[model samples]
Every structure is written in structure tokens, then in C-alpha cells.
Target: MGIRMIHHICIQTEKYTESLDFYTRILGFEVVSETANFHNREYNTWLKIGDFMIELQTPKAGDKFNVWSSLNGGPVHMGFLVDSVEEEYERIVELGYKDFKVKNGKIVYEVEGESLFKIKAPEGTEIEIRDTDIK
Candidate 1:
């Protein structure tokens, strides 16, 4: 069987509201669908803007994973394909998001092809901005 495109990417966050704002406002992701628990609290949310679909989910009260813990040392990080890495990088910075690509307020020049940048999500997840259309 041939491989199809990625249907969605699931992101687990502790601060749901902040994460929602970061994705929708900072990155311009649109909420296409959502699922809430018995108390009408969001348990899972599907956000999309183009062919890309991102699912934001939060762990239960008795869940094992502690979302607040700093797991920044982990190598697992999600990447999003943007139209222009430089432009997206600037926009993310303007939105008061941390630019992990910058050093001491100086912007380093990136190579021509296969470029990428990083922006920290509200939940401390590294949201990568990649300059490629391959999904």
C-alpha cells in the first residue's frame, strides 16, 4: 500500500487556553473541530488552516504525564511547514513568543535550502517553523 499524507498531529498541553491562543493567534491555526468532557471542558481540539490538521489534547486528572514538568531536554519536537521561514520567524517574535533561533538579539543568517526555525509553544513544546511544502 502507498503512504498517504499526514491526517493530523496531536499535541499534549497542560495550559489549554494558552496553548489554544498560541496556535490560533500566533500561528494562525483555525479550530475545525473539538471534543469536551462532561463538564464542558475541552479534552481534545482539532485545529487546521490548510491541508495541515493539529489536534490539541490535555491529559486527565490522574494521568501519569506531568505537563508542567520541563521536558525540554527531550529530542521530540513538532515541526510546521511555513511559507517563509524568515517571515514566520519575525511574526512569531512580534507576537511575544520566544525565538530559540536568536542569540543575544542578533539574527543569524540561515542557509538557502532546507531552512528551519524554532518557537516555543505555551506548554514549553518546541514548535519548529520549516521552509518546505512537503507534508
Candidate 2:
């Protein structure tokens, strides 16, 4: 048996438009397909970058888990590997986002000599940005 790379990551969000904007405009994920009222969802959007895809869905109205809340054993957060964490961090900051952790006026944080940073997604999910060459 062999294992391959991640196919996609699914995110449920009530802020459909905002999340779409965040992924498409800010993060630069191209929209592969967007369907309204797909499989009981208000919207089901498939966004892609390189070989990875992000499946974003909006739940039906009045759904309990429609809001951004931890699933108590679901994924804690998601991350993306980038060429340069510093460049990505600066680009995000230039977009007028202020959801990153800062210490000593620096948004990038070092862990065990690795350069990385975290930014909150529109739905409050922590998206970690890491250097591609990190070991």
C-alpha cells in the first residue's frame, strides 16, 4: 500500500462570502467549481492551488454546527507550506489583516529554529504558514 498527498480539506463556515474572499482573493486559491445548494449546503465551493484543493461549504440555515466551533476531536487547525514564511507574513499584513501573533514587533515566530507563523482564517481557524524547506 502507498499513501499520497492530501486531496482536500473541508471547512464549514457561516460566513460564506467572507471565507470565499479570504481563500480566493487573499490566499490566491483559484476556484475550481462553485455550486449553489449542493448536497444540502447553501454553497459548496472547491478551490484549488497547485495539487491541493479546499472544499468550502455553507450549511443549511438553522444548522447547529453552522458556526465556527471546534468539533471536539476534529482537526485543530490547518497549515500551508510556503516558499518563504517571511514573505507570506508580510503579504498578509499588507492586506490589512491583524490576526497574527506578534512578539517584539515581529509576526513570524520561531520554533526550534524553524520560521513559521499563524493567521486566523475568517471563520477563526488557525492557518499556519511554514517554510517549505523546514525540516
Candidate 3:
């Protein structure tokens, strides 16, 4: 089967509200839908960024799970397209998120003619930002 594109990514959070705020305020995502599963005792909120969607969920009581640990080494990194890598890097620093720096103005990945900058999320998830179009 030929895949088209990624539909959405689900992330589990300890606190739903806190994660919602971080994605909405810091990462610039807009809420598209929200619901609470009463039968399962879980909560979920969906946010949209460009053509992608991020689904945030909170586990039910007595659920044995840790979101951060599960995300380690998974294919779940989200990349944001930006105009300037330096500007976005500076903004992330000013916002107080611990970030990995690129030494000597190095770019993370080169695709086509674009420059990439990778940043880590509050939960140590790597996010790649492309300053140019990927061709």
C-alpha cells in the first residue's frame, strides 16, 4: 500500500491542561477538537499545525504508563517550517526551553536546499525545524 501522509500523532501527558497550554502557547497549535472518554476515564485534545495534527491524551486512573519514557527513540518527532533558524533558536531559548545548540553555525540536515535546526521538547522529544523547502 502506498502511504499518503501522516494523519496525526498521539502524545500522553500527565496533566492534560498543562500540555495543552504548552502546545497552544509555545508551539503555536490551535485546538481543533476535544473530548473525554467517560467509559475509559481518559481525556483527549486535538491540535492542528499546518497540515498535521497532534493528539494529546491523559490516561485513566490506575493506568501503568509514562509518556516521556514511551517517547524515547520513537518515530514521533515533529518538524516545523521556519523562515530563519537563528531566529527560531533564539526564540526557543528566550522561552526558557533547554535546547541543544549547533556549534559553528552548523545545520542539522540538508534536504534539497533547506537548512535544518533540531530542538528538543520539554519531554526530550526531538523537533526538527526546516528553514527552507524540502525538495
Candidate 4:
């Protein structure tokens, strides 16, 4: 159990501008990262309050689940902070869990230099295991 904390929660939204304003202006969350046309989405933004974060993503061009067709809002995934991503990935493999995101023959992937891996929960929520020691 190297997990340190619940890192962040992701929210998928069609009202990107409105949600961004609500989180930043109304709720007073500060933007940590903001990228346009990220992963084929209109915007991918990260807002934070102290150590915890909220990831807001606009609907992708071809979302398999039709995320926007329903209510157009809700959580998509959650990230957990870990002491060491490599150790956690190894532990997960040793525990016999077979489904997780992999890149270039490695289970751990890097996003903006942060090491992490994503796995789907039983009800289809994505869970990101991430290393907390960011340089």
C-alpha cells in the first residue's frame, strides 16, 4: 500500500467554458494546467485546490460511450497518488490484475513527465495510479 492520497478527479463536460469559469471563478480553484486541442478534445484543463486537483475535459470527437448525449456532466475517472509508480505497477501485476493501460511494452506511461497508468473499474470508471514524486 504505497498509495499516499487521492490525487484528482476528472469531470467530463460539454460546457467547457462554463465549467471552467465555475471552477475557477465561482469556486476559486486555480488552474494548474490548460491545453487546447488536447488528445483531440477542445480543451483539457487541470484545476487545483492545495494538493487535490480536478481535471476537466471537453468531449472528444468520437467518444465511444457518447459522454455528451446523456446529461453532459459527471466524473470520468480518479487518480490516486502513490509513493512509487514502478512499485505499484509491479504489485498490481503480482496481484494478477491483467487489464491496465500500457505503452511501449511498459505498463507505466508518462504524461508531462508524471508517471502513471490507468485501469478500468468494474463499473467502467477509470482509475489512474500515479507517482507523487514529480520533479
Off by over 4 Å in 1: 38-42, 67-75, 99-115, 132-135
State the displacement of the C-alpha of residue 22, model 1, in Å, after optimal TM-score superposition.
0.9
How does each model score on lDDT? 0.74, 0.83, 0.71, 0.71
Best by lDDT: 2
Number of the top candidate by TM-score?
Answer: 2
Error of 2 at 31 (Å): 0.4
* Cα RMSD, each candidate: 3.9, 2.4, 3.9, 13.8
| Residue 82 Cα positional deviation in candidate 4, in Å, after optimal superposition | 27
Model 4, 1-135: lDDT tens digits are 799998887877776776676556533479999999998998899999778888888779876444332234755555667788888777766755666766788778888878898765332346688876545
User: Per-candidate TM vs. native?
Assistant: 0.72, 0.85, 0.69, 0.47
Q: Candidate 3: which pairs clash?
A: none
Worst 10 residues of 1 by lDDT: 102-111
Q: 1 or 2, which is superior by TM-score?
A: 2
Candidate 2: residue 30 Cα off by (Å): 0.4
Report the candidate with higher lDDT, 1 versus 3: 1
TM-score of candidate 3 against the unseen true structure: 0.69
Q: Model 1, residue 124: displacement in angstroms?
A: 2.5
Give candidate 4's TM-score. Answer: 0.47
